[model samples]
Target: MSKIVIGKYEGTIYPEKGGYTGALALGFGPDGKRRRLKRKGRTRSQVLDRLKAAVVDLETGVKSPANYNVGEAVEDWLAKGLRGLDDDTVVNYRSLAGKHVIPLIGKVRLKDLRADDVGEWLDGLAGSLSSRSLRLVHAILKRAIRQAQARDMVIRNVAELVKTPKGTAGRPSRALTLDQARAVLEAAQSSRLHAYVVVSLLTGIRTEEARAMQWDHVVAQADGEAGWRPVTADGFEHEKFAIYVWRSVRAHGDTKTEKSRRTLELPGQAAEALRRHHARQAAQRLRAGEEWRDHGLVFCSTTGRPLDAANVRRAFRLITRKAGIGESWSPRELRHSFVSIMSDSGVPIEAIADLCGHSSPAVTGEVYRHQLRPVITRGAEVADAVFGPGKSA
Candidate 1:
């Protein structure tokens, strides 16, 4: 049995109501504030361990007298502050909070939490999350704390002072070469995602945009007699055989940006695959009869429901494996492959930006231009002419 100290601050051991070992600690906080902390544990050592921490908290005045925890703050922001966000964004924020923030630091009282505590917590996650994901996690905590501060609930947002730790380097993003793109297309021709692969690879449409494509948005023919064609100042037709990228699978069916709503010219491969897919879907609908749910999504399951992203990823991996390509790829990578292929084929960045519905050409150059290998040796020759003979190249 442990001896109880005679001082005003000491730890004591006792039996709880269930006959389990319990610990209680009496301590003096800052400015002679008396504090009593209690805890129950499976063993005497465990109870004493908690009492030690309580003593430390009392000594340092680290235990804030605030009424709320981090979890309450995060949940409040998620429920009230995210009222107008996209469904996917809200889902992602909820997942980040639940998976990272809540379990680790949720119970810490608002005023008790310090920047050092948050820094240490984030530093502990360096091995599990990637740099991009770490940024997102930091953003989530910071936004939640700021929201709480705005309501006068908390005096300070400690999360703002904590820097995001550099997380593990993520997988290097890559795009398929021209030959690999063709191979992927050939393999996908026999798969159910043929239309999706064709549309994404050829048109550079985002996976979200393609996933939300509907039959009404697809325009197979261009109007000739009605003079509805777009013309420049020089009087030239811009494009034909188009699809209106008017919506995505997000909540309320909104695109990523205003420029993301432009029309796209359907290439030959995309049009052919879409035509065949239409026939196949019609047959599937006939077979399903009354069991089919018609949500009017172009790329859907046999039951006519929208395709789940995970299911599509799994299916795409199967296709890539069958094509003798490595299976470490996602559907969104196909758009990158499209951008790379276009850049390599000498398509101007401005034109590619227009085709891909980017807000500006600068973004296209910044993201894809340098990453792509040029098919022509002209630029290399010019560099050689300007910089003398290369010592190694």
Candidate 2:
């Protein structure tokens, strides 16, 4: 309950109390509703200044009585300010608060929270988490504190005064050699999933994009020279068989990027693999009958449901182990191999960039340079010719 006190002037005022921080919730005139006057400044004098301002405002009929907490401020911010953010981003923020921020300083009075408190919290965070994670924690807290200030709850946002730790970068990626890639494909040949592997390597599409492919996007109509059609007589295109990449499946949602949504011409080997896999999947669908989902996905489980990416990874690991290929690799490695092999084969970087749907050759080079280094070295042979016979430059 708010305590009512007559203003130094003529008006009666009710000032609410007991917030996350020190506050002065000033009420209004006799007939008018209450007005909240909180101190957002960190210093006592600052809080008093805010309180005095609220008192004057109440005397002048300016604002309403308001007193809120850190928790309340967070809820309001999430509801009103975070509406445009995606579900995953919201979930992540909530998780960060629950796991790290709230437990430490949630009980502190919004107005009473000090820079020292925020700094201590960050110091503790540094001991257990990566610099990046700590920075995230700081960012979340800073936003929450700023919101509290805007709401007139806190005297100051301590998070603003604290410094965030620097973040760490991960090691560079390692790509597979030509022999290793061939070995992986050969090992994958006997599996029902062989076509998927071939397409991933040949097309350089991400796993999610590859998995999301539908039967509608595979064009088989040779307009004349060398282009695939939107659809074929057998239901999809490609001489080897039907294939498509119309939609991607994600655990939380869909494809990671809008640009990843694309269609491409399937190579003969990949098309054949798809033909065989499609046949096998069709038989399974026939057996399942009413139990099948019929998602129309080109790559799916026996009942037409999308395969889990995690399950795909595990199976891929098994295939590599069986192939006697020891170096660590993931499905993405094949995408790198595609770029590498294309570059080595003398395909213009621009053309390869288009084939891989890369935004620019620079990005393609940056990502696959580990694999494309050999091409760069071989191109140096031109320098050898210019400099005279057999001179290593």
Candidate 3:
């Protein structure tokens, strides 16, 4: 047994239960009551270390409990930090936290978590996860720790100090060639998804945007100065049509980005397909009678319910298979196909970017780099002309 004086407080260290215990009075609390902190460890030095940490925490206004662990902080962030986010996004973050973060370091005390610990955890995941997934997991951990730090739970965010390790490469996005696109279009001509496939491939709208499209957004030219009217309007007749891309299936029915909200003129093929599809839908609605629910979505199931992404993918695969393109193709590739076709047809980068609802041409170039063709080839021809077909000497 011994006495330790830390600043003005006289503390005592005593042997208890085969371990050393340290106790100190940390002055009066806000409620005018005396406050104290205690630390116990297997050795006197260990007890001293804990006592010192407690004193620093007290001085710094940190109110985190000694038993607080990583899992608790992650759960707190998951519960509060994810408010107002899309439901799918919330679910994804929760799934990642549950599967990767909580299971591995959940038991580690928040105070004891270190940059080395985070680095090691990410490295362990690098072998199994894709680089994109690893980055997302790392971001989740960093954000969780940041939330804890804001609440004075931890001194610093160790996750932020550690860099995300490179993981396995994800599958590279590919676009259908012109011939394959034609084949797919032909195969879809007789299917219920004909309009969906045509619109997605020709307009380059995101699958989420397509799924959320409402019939009210589909407008056609009218005779007045303010000429646009929804096709659903009575006596609607127009040679030209367009759609207002205003919303998506995301939580709260908002589009993905401000730039994602745009008006796109429908290609002739897409418009024709949609006209036929609308007629077919009206017939189906009559058949379903009271069973049909009017969500007002342009694309829906037999009962007018919104189509699930999984079901859309399954139906899309059947069309690709029928076109002899195999079943591995996804609906998103239709957008990529649009970019590739437009690029190959000599569309300007900026025009293509706007058409695809991208924020900028640079973003389009970066994302669809594989699909964009070099608009300039005269440089090589001029060089060849200047070189005069020179032979190597």
Per candidate, the number of residue pairs that clash is 0, 19, 0
lDDT values, one for every candidate: 0.74, 0.63, 0.85
Choose the strongest candidate by TM-score. 3
Worst-scoring 10-residue span by lDDT in model 2:
377-386
**Ranked by TM-score, top first:** 3, 1, 2
**Candidate 3, poorest ten consecutive residues by summed lDDT:** 379-388
lDDT of 3 by residue, 120-223 (tens): 99999999999999999999888988999899998888888888889998888889987788788889988889899988987889998999999999998876
Ranking of all predicted structures according to lDDT, beginning with the best and ending with the worst: 3, 1, 2
User: Candidate 1's C-alpha lDDT?
Assistant: 0.74
* TM-score per candidate, chains pooled: 0.71, 0.62, 0.81
* Tens-digit lDDT track of model 2 for 1-393: 233233542222233343223344444758798755445444444555566666654555433234445555566666676665654467677887778887776766555567888888888877677787788778887887677566555566777888986545534455556666667777887875687887787677777677777766665755343555444244434343324444555543455555544556565666666667767887998899999998767778778887766567777777788778763567766777777766665666766666666677787777776666333322212212322233221
- Tally clashing residue pairs in candidate 3: 0
Global lDDT of model 2: 0.63
RMSD of each: 10.5, 8.9, 8.4
Stretches off by above 4 angstroms in model 1 are 1-67, 150-152, 222-240, 373-393
Worst 10 residues of 1 by lDDT: 229-238
TM-score of 2: 0.62
